[model samples]
Target: MHGPEIVTTLLEMADDGQTRPTPSDAWHLFLSGLRQRFRLPSGRPLAVIAAVLIASIVGGFGAAAGSWAAERTFADLPSQARVEALTRQASPGDDYSYDRSTSAWGTDTTMGALTVSDWDPASARDRFAADGWQVTTVRDMSAGALAYTNDPATGSMTPLPVRGSQFDAVRDGVFLRVTGYVSPGHGTVSVMLWPDDTAAMLPLMLAGAVLGLVAGWMLAAAGAYRMRPLPAGRRRVATVLTGLAVTALALPAFAFYVNMTRVLGPSGSFVNTVHSALNASPYWSYSTPRMLLLLTVTGAVLAGAAWATMGRRGRSTPAADQIPTTG
Candidate 1:
């Protein structure tokens, strides 16, 4: 119908008592308004968006995979049982107390102090050496300590002794160190045991990242293709939500990997020991479980939106058809 005739017909329908609007009418009108407002990108712009979305997915998955691999590498380290056993042993004439615990990030720490009468540094060194430990003095440990936590002036525990004499050794990939504070006739010795698997973990983490990148790329490509049929407005919203969810999912992985790197080596000018690194900042700032829950909720919402709008074919009306036409 022509414009005037169409308007008159609509006015006549509005005057009829039976022409009342239904709930469905309001809903369809709302959706129609949204479709007009949020135009979909076509051609090159759409392709570019798909590419960016795919990249985000791939990167997030890569980092997550690497972090998981790194954790496995740590857990696979030699003999936790043996390490725990050695960590609990104390020499005769020494009053010892120790505590052992594991962190959320999968680090095992054994720390304790020993009170001994007649503090003899040589005897202490020899005793550890006899246990097949290549013991070294605190001075040597300070010099050879990991650059990540070596601060001589601050007297931090990067394998350094606070007072008197300190000795440490590395065996079976475990760190064994003793810090002694001696007085007139006796002394208090602090002992710490830690596992060092950095040399084995980094390469595995890199490999995992590579694998995840490939997997994410494939998945993103398929997902983008599936979303092609959705309306521009819905597609864009879904894409943004998916991107953010992927980012949230991957955050802990990358953060963990970075923290591990810092713990193992120097992070710019900032230094960190494994204990201090895991227990401080970023890692301690938020809950991993909560971030994961967010990812799950976001995914569900995206899926529900898609199911509602994408139809049985999981496709929307063609982008070309949605474009306005004027004569």
Candidate 2:
């Protein structure tokens, strides 16, 4: 029978009170129905098993490839040097040093200190402007510092102003903040630079992974439904169990294969190690586990419902055959 007709029949039997069976009974009947419908070459069952494994492997690898591509794209974003050059130009005579610099696949941030003998906010702003940096605002360090707070409830810290004069600017895609502090004999300029694109890239990476997962599941399901059906009187419970196993195994198998092939080194062995690359992968950490559980439960429930419907149909058929015919 066609996929839709089989599914519809199962659903109708599930909805009909007389035919509705318990979850376990329904699953058994579903497996029996599948066996009967797909009774082709004797090797049909084995082929279905192989198809599920192949589908899962393709799905897992496809997700991994897409995720890696996203990371590579993010890595191509503009670097902090784009802003640092402007800072150097703004404070030519000052001795400059990077206070802190951090980088990830999609983002980079650098904070630098410039030691100068004099503090001239106006001259600094003009210098930055001449170098194509658009001055955003100039404010007293004390006023900016007032915005800093430690939230007791959340235990989160907000940005605090450095001990100096504050200047904010934007050039190209970089956000720059320059703070100048003047003492009796010493003055210091602080430069902070960040790219605007990092904020948007993270969400896109996560979204891409999710989309890949869904596409994989649909492909596997469709392939399974369209394959040759199982033979009649095949062990109903065994068939249902095998389906469940396939559903559960496909995701982890895909995850393991991808992780081992892509993340592990040539010398690396997949022995008794508890750690896996999938666990470390940002995209896979949460999504893979949840998808595995959801798919397994869904497969079991569907099988049970299909089995129950088939059993109801079987019992009703015999009774109908036994009934007296109108002459």
Candidate 3:
């Protein structure tokens, strides 16, 4: 059309407020158009949301299952059996430490015999005998020292001199027979944490798992929204990377893991070996397995969402049909 024809047409369309928009108007219209297009599908987004809810439920259940499994798996693991009550925390004005590798509940070591502190061995043994306790077996690791191993064949006796009033003062003053590995300084004190029912701790693990699920959902939602839907292969890569990132950050979520390692070591310790690292950290009720449930489920859900949003890049979608087609 000629310049005048076009100008006249523009003026007429403008008078009625129906003119073809300029480039700046077009840019705004395009942005607005995208908002309308990406508005999640009605029933579809709900289905996705429902799927996430199901995932959370599964997560909670899964945590309980994992706890059950760990309980069973680690039950027969080399353990310490302690029947002694905690006399006090870090005993006031007294410094006593047993080397975990060198000490044991039932077995006496040369290290202990050599470092006889605070009491006389001859007197302790003599006192024990006077209390009507028949000494079953005494092994002399060296001179002037003896470790007596009592047998159950003997009747439940009263008390020994070495035990002192402090040991005998407790209401639960019955002596116990314990069996476990001997660590250096832990001695009789470290052998007590064994054979605790793992199932008792399951509920706590499951709670952590539940919390993990919520965190997973948020992470997945945020990541899925941030990533521009890509081609199929790229989408998979993105999801995997996102899942890994989530997994890597998991350790920082708890100060306990740090503290646990500092104090507990490979198998963990019965004593307060890790006092320095301990902190007043809030722990999730079922944090452990719950977090696993969250991360896995969330990552999986995000993967699916990423897949749905990232169809063939060059392809068209039915949802996009409502937009005006241009030649």
Candidate 4:
């Protein structure tokens, strides 16, 4: 052919819809390639939804794990030596009658008796403030009870009253409660400490959530792909098992989160807030043995289904049409 004809033919071929892909077509092809490569099942909205729910549960677990791990990075209770030193430095003239220091449930406490001193509450407050402590009078305990009790008239929470000579102090993200009765020459003193480290926890929890989301998505994709060829009866059973497994995982995490919210709510002292934040108690408390048993059984059944269907072919394709045979 002449060069002009050849050029015209090339232009026509380029313009043909089937000859070249548009940007949208290319994007779709790329996505399709990815789906096939990953063996992701398509055309199943329920499977996708189930995967999303699974991911949410897994992501919650990751966040909880991250928060729990982050708490360990901070000291929940101050050292015994530091507690002793603070008491000695705070009241130099007073001699100790008894010294008892203990740690429990995210709180560190020290109590001792003094053989009488002229030190009053004001002086103690000033001393605490001088030592970088933010001092404030403790709130009335009655107010805390009132917060939970039903208010027949208003049904709204009543604010706590800032009364009492007992002091609550915070310093460097650590909380301290100072309580005692002091007179002209005798008294008992108690100091309790709780630590807070929320700054580091937030970032770790976010990272954990992202990781969990990815893992959950991949797992869901794999499960959907594996069950793509399952018979109707077997598929129904598998779907039930999946639902049971998701419920088993979700309930504990939901219960734990709710409890944490309640514990961290505005009702009690800041001491309670710090304790709840650092306690990390719900992981074990909510994940009971019965829940674990349910999860295990569902998982086992699903695994058995997969094993039983191994090496089986999908629904057979219809035989191709054949031309009529000549006599």
Q: Write the number of the candidate with greater lDDT, choosing between 2 and 4.
A: 4
Provide TM-scores for the models: 0.54, 0.39, 0.24, 0.51
User: Which residues of candidate 2, in runs, are more than 4 Å off?
Assistant: 1-84, 92-94, 103-106, 143-163, 198-210, 219-327
Q: What is the C-alpha lDDT profile of model 4 across 1-327, one tens digit per residue?
A: 123443344444466455655688668757965565345566778877987887776676666566566666655555667776655544544565434432212333344444334345567778889888888964333232211233569987544322224677777776677665443333445565666444565566667667777777776776786677777887777777677667656654454344345434553443221222223233345443355335535654654555354324343332233222348
Clashing residue pairs in candidate 1 (N, C-alpha, C atoms within 3 angstroms): 229-316
Report every candidate's CA lDDT. Answer: 0.52, 0.51, 0.35, 0.55
lDDT of 2 by residue, 1-327 (tens): 344444455555575465656788779978976555433334456654544454554455454444445344432223457445656655654666764432211234567677776677778888888878779667777443333457788899764444467777776666677777765455677777654332333244344445545554554343344332334544454345546655664665455444434432342111111113333224254574345445545654654554443332111132333333457
Ranking by lDDT: 4, 1, 2, 3
Point to the candidate with the largest TM-score: 1
- Give one clash count per candidate, in the order shown: 1, 11, 27, 2
Worst 10 residues of 2 by lDDT: 267-276
Candidate 1: tens digits of C-alpha lDDT, residues 30-137: 786445333333454754564454454445445444544454544233344554344334333455566775554435567777676545667767777888887776
Worst 10 residues of 4 by lDDT: 271-280
Q: Judged by lDDT relative to the true structure, which candidate is superior, 1 or 4?
A: 4
